[model samples]
Target: MAAKPGQCTERPKSVPGRTAVLPWRLAPGIALFAAVALSMIFAGSMLGLAISRPWLGLGLSPFAPVAKLQDEGALWLTAVEGPAARAGIPPEPARILSIAPLGPGAAGGAVLLTGADIMEEPDVLPSHAGMAAYFARQNQLAGLMAEPVELHIAALEEAGSDTPPPTAVYRITPERRRPLTSLPAAFWMQIGVGLSGFWIGVWIWTLRRGDWAARFLAVAGTGLMASAFPAAVYSTRELALPDPLFWALSSLNATGSLTFGVGMIGLFLIYPRRLVRNQFLFVPALVLGLWRLADMLEWIDGPALGRHLAILTAMGAIIVLVGLQFRATKGDPRDRAALTWLGLAVIIGAGAFVTTVILPVALGVSAVVSQGQAFLFFLLIYGGMALGVARYRLFQLDEWAFRILFYVTGVLLLLVLDAILIVTVIDERAPAFALSLLVVALLWLPLRDMLGRLVLRRREPQRGALFRQVMDVALTPPGHDQRAIWAALLEGLFQPLTLSPLENATQSSITDEGAGLVVGGVGGLPAYRLDFADQGRKLFAPADVALADELRAMLTNALESRAAYEKGVAEERLRIARDIHDNIGVQLMGALHSLEPRRKDQLIRETLTDLRDIVNNASNPELSFDEMLADLRAQISEHVFAAGMRMEWVVEGGDSVILPLANAHTLRSVVREAVQNALKHADAGLVRIVIRQGDDAIFARVEDDGKGFDISADYRGNGLENMRARIIALGGDLSMISGAGGTRIEARFPFGAERRRR
Candidate 1:
């Protein structure tokens, strides 16, 4: 048996439950927590260290060789000025007395002390006598000095001498100068280690944050810090250097500073939001680093190159920091905090460099401090960034933190192993080779994991959600009330992901009496179908196949249901008609025929009235096809009687027909319209209604024999046009032909076709 429309043959209710949301899946929150925890730990440790050793708090050491020379010279000049004033002798102008370090077994330059002027040559004292007197005074001063010093003083009477005379000169040979100590070497090593650690930390942090640009900036920052040592050495040798190396180093220093500033600005701009793409900033920074390396090897002019190294290094650091800051701050509030930290780092570093490193070298400042300030500042900035990445998962921080942590830990472990190798390996080359192998082995897993996480993190959330939603909808079984569920799923997936308007191409529907619905398309593509069932618990089939089948099933069910309801109503109406016609009509006829002459007329009239009442009562309900055909036959018979014309009536093929009350009423209206047109316009004596059912169509044909008119010219204003429209609205087609002999109207309805098309 064919199942009725909307009736599921078997209702399968049992289905598995939906998957629950998991706690570990929230990457953002996890990342945030990790970053915050790490930052706090580092910060606390540094803060505690600072409190314990306030002098070691954070700054570069102010005890470079040049700085020491300037300090001692300035001090000696001050002391000499006081003595000269006390003795009532005019003071000699201040000058530097420097002893250049010599080669093996050779005496370096003497303490060449030259000044602007000495006591004005007395008129009584000649040039030779003045020189002798100055030497005697120097010898007396040397005898009074704590350390043994050689005196070599000369006085020139000529004011315009090309070379100024030595005034109160003292020569300090290699024996007199203090021997170089290991303390400076140890201090510098500590500074290097601290700075190197800070840079390494920053690189790890940037990598973890998925900030390639930041990683580059961190490298540049490290380069800048490292340049400081070379810069100091070069500056100390500035006076002995040739021209080319001096200019080259100076230019390099300028370039490095510019590069470092640019890099810092870039880091700042890209740190939080990570959007800057400019590569020009890195070019100068790389060039400076390479040039410094070349200069260190003496591949370039050594002395001159050494002269400008300090400025170049400082310039590089500044450029990188500035570039980072500029890039990082370009983002919104979410990134503002991180960018601010980077900015603070640049400011603190530059300030410390200027005060401790630059000012002391340029001026004769006597203040002395440790060289850990820049390192500490760097640690804070990069550490904070790493913490931000771990805690907030800034730029996929959660994914980044694990990978970064792994890489950092692995690298540290490798470094430790290398240190072990150095201690244990006998061969000089073995340790380095072993260290390289250990690094590669240690980094492999972490690098792989980092790459995997990066790829995963890049997938868009909305697209993933949409895919899940579609799969959920498709897999659910038939007979499930999935309309509301589908709607909710669609809304959830689409609302957040919708960057543009969606084009709805296919019509959607829900079964009126069951638990299933049809969805029209997939991923905004061409029309396909999806049907969810079993309370959206399981899938019946693939979306396209199921949806198409479900739609066909729905159409068939609706048509059959309508057909059954109409038939039942028609049968009920037919029964009532039969009862009135057979029983009541016979009785009325019998009474009228058997009545006496005088009372026969009255009896006949009363019987006729009774018959009419019975017929009226039977026809009072809405007309069915059978009832309509019966009435039309009677009406045409009456018309034939009244008009005194030969009238033929025929009804064909309406056997088990049924229609809804609304549609039955519409049909009646169509019939009435056709009959009225025949009566009013056709002026016909004979009327015919031919209802025939075909495989694809149901048709009603009404024809008449009367005065006919042109269908094209007169039908537009006639009642026939109205009848055609009425029939057409009911998913039927209507046609009218009127000519000299007759008028004919025909209408055909294709059952269920119109609804299916929609």
Candidate 2:
């Protein structure tokens, strides 16, 4: 039913008649619903027959050989054997008596001596001679009689009380036991196939309530169930059933198969992509259905000709599918994946049936598997058809199906080999288990990886990786560029040709055709436009939006980190300015009151040195002890030489060691102030400074040979007080000695204070 030119093929006109009277839209659905309901009733009836036949004992016997129940007063003969029948015992309703032995043991014969013998045996041949005693005396007479024994029984006439004892005796003998019967594989096979078809039909009908393919599938399911019902019924304990029931079931089976075959052909003809007119496809179903009728009625000995017709029709349907696939390949690419899967289902399912059912049965051997069981493989085909009709995404199903199939088959083979080795070669259970684990570990994961790649072909795009690289470059230290990172991330993800702030645009999304998405940037970043045309993709999928969003989040984090780092740098500079204003600024203002030019000039020099040190080490204020000592000696010598005083500086064991910024800064300040005070007030021409390093302390002594001064009077100066306060703040000792030997300033810094400062 290919669509006419300039018309869509998806929706076809409803079939004619009473269905056409209703709204055209609802008629197809109503018709399909009616078809599905009829299918349900037919299939349900078949399942009932399958279930009821077992309990009723139709077509097979459920119990062993037995006779009818009788009363002891009657003493009737029941279930008579051939010997008793041939000896003039009537196969009629009558009363019987027990047997008694006569003559010697080797030549013994049995006779009905008296009626009391029958009464004495409560449930045996004489007293219990009917169905009640059949189990006890079924074949026991032969064991009781040695050699070939003859037994005589007196029986009453039908509908009479008393009768004369028969003079003639009957011979009884034992026979070999016959083997019991079991249900054939065909019985189980039919049930499995039929039940699978029934369920699949129901599922399709329910899922696609208005679809023509679903209605056709229901027909196939009904036929399968009808065919299986008779088999299930006959499988029960063997019992002859009415001929009419068998004929009825067989007719239904044949009709259902014909209907199923027709439905299959029709379904493929119209669904996904129509290849032929629906009306023209029914000729084969009608012809095959007539043949099935003749076969079921015993009018022809066609040798399973009905089944052959069904197979032929199924093959025709497959050929039609191939034609449809060819059409799809040339003109309709969208339908290609669906038809390909349908073809695979047919190939695999038919192959299974031929290998497991038809070939074995044709060879006169038991089938490798039952027909019904093999038909279960057809369910996979039905499932694929349903998926196709519904237009569900196949994704990479066609491309990966074979790879997955091969990988699974290979794994099964490996497991089989492992089992063979464990049984034949590996004797110790522990070693065998270890070897099995090793093999699985080596083979299983790699196989899974290979299969997974085939199935899920989408990989992270190169642009995504490039975006991350840009973010890393922007975020690296010394160049924290937030704007650059944001721009790069957006460009990589969207590739918009005309990227700009969205403020000027009428809408957040660009008004231009083929616009993708708009992101309202936060944290001072302006909104942006993304155009799809520039990226070469006409539209954006949800996955693309999600990728862009994730990248945006990463860019946001990078921006925040950069902002925080810049804020930290700015705050550090401010802190340095405040420290100089509070400590060194107050010292210079206090020195203005000294009144001597030299003292003021000396204060200015020391202040300038302090400013330079603070500025130079603001970023990283930590210094090694050797470096600190060099800077300190340079400051001291400059002040000492300007005052015309000779200086001697010595350092011991100070290399390869470091100090915290606070400790080093305070030590340099204290030394600088002490040397300046020596040059100004000591009045001595020589000054000796010794710096010593101990295991736990740094000791420095500034000794000068100058006139002694009053220590208490000069203790109020800002220089002395600032030096003492700074040393104490760093957990060190500072002391001043004024005497003829010149004032010596001793200072000690503890390692514990340096560690705490760090």
What TM-score would each prediction reach against the true structure?
A: 0.29, 0.39
- CA lDDT of each prediction against the hidden true structure: 0.44, 0.54
Candidate 2 clash figure, as a count: 13
Q: What is the lDDT of residue 451 in candidate 2?
A: 52
- Per TM-score, the best of the predicted structures is 2
lDDT: which candidate is best? 2
After the best TM-score superposition of candidate 1, give how far the Cα of residue 161 lies from its true spot, in angstroms.
36
Candidate 2 lDDT, 303-393, residue by residue in tens:
2333543455565666667676557556433345445666676557655665665454434444575344666676666555545333322
Give residue 16's error in model 1 in angstroms. Answer: 46
Model 1, range 1-758, lDDT digits (tens) per residue? 65321112443344469555433432433443344345334433422322221010011122222332433222123222222233332333233343232335444344443321111111112233443344454333322232323333333224446776556544332122111221134334433433443344454444433344545554555445434322322232201222343334334444444445445544544454434344454554566557656644546543234324444355455556555555655533333444454455556655555455444534434323433333243444444444544433343334444555555555545555666567666346575657656666867666766655553333233544454344334322212222333455543422221111224636554432222334453322233222233223222223323444444344335435434655765785786578667766665676667656766666667666665555445356334456655545544544443544444444555354545444554555666677666766666767766666555566777778888888778767867667767667767787777778788777876554322210
lDDT of 1: 0.44
Clashes of each: 70, 13
